[model samples]
Target: MGILLLMARERVPRVMRGEIPMASIAVERDAYPLKARLLSNNFDNQFQLPVLFYVGALLAILFQPGWPEVVLAWLFVATRYVHAYIHVTHNRVGKRFMAYAAGLAVLALFWLWLILRLLILAPSI
Candidate 1:
């Protein structure tokens, strides 16, 4: 969303300059296919993989896991920053994949820990 907003800010001048048609801003892809399009795609990405984070976080909070789980959650969020950096900047495929995989692994660990806490540890708690 921040990236989208920044892109929109940058685009205002282009729109005023008549470089990109106002009507074609959202719909017509072929008409405007470059920085603007990349920004839109990047914005769309926020909704894709991060949904897992939201679910994992909700479960973690509901279960009230220990500090280790909280650390793991923070690790996942850190990876997201790295992922976004790689995505918006250099955007190297291999680098981006590594960051994304790291985040996914952290998220998976978070879910695993939460599940264990719920099923195994919760009985004792």
Candidate 2:
């Protein structure tokens, strides 16, 4: 096992030098391909969903739940920033998905928690 691990480690630089199987979606030498263009569009769409949610949360806080709910909503938006960084900068695979999933989970939980809290705890005020 140790020998195999050492072999893998030795290959790491070679992989970075384009020896590895190309798992990248689409790539071109010195040119951004269609995949990169599509990813950019995807980045833009997902970039705003969480932010809009937080703006809703802020409105609810200043005018209508509690501070905690607002924080929860905003944190998800921040997570999307991390997601984009991973997806674009490093081209990392799993990390972007995890960050994206976390952001979505936070958004869903925020909405549910806010609605339930508003119904069960906070009265019309």
- In order, how many clashes per candidate? 0, 0
Indicate the TM-score of model 1. Answer: 0.84
Per-candidate Cα lDDT values, in order, are 0.79, 0.63
Best by lDDT: 1
**Total colliding residue pairs, candidate 1:** 0
Give the TM-scores of the predictions, in the order they appear.
Answer: 0.84, 0.57
Tens digits of per-residue lDDT, candidate 2, 42-120, equal 4455646667675667766764556667688668868877886666467566887788788888887787777677667
Candidate 1 residue runs with Cα over 4 Å from true position: 28-30
State the lDDT of candidate 1 residue by residue for 1-125, as single tens digits.
67878668767778888987878867665555466666666677778768988987887787766897889989988998888777777788899899989988988888888888888888797
RMSD of each: 2.0, 11.3
Residue pairs with colliding backbones in model 2 are none
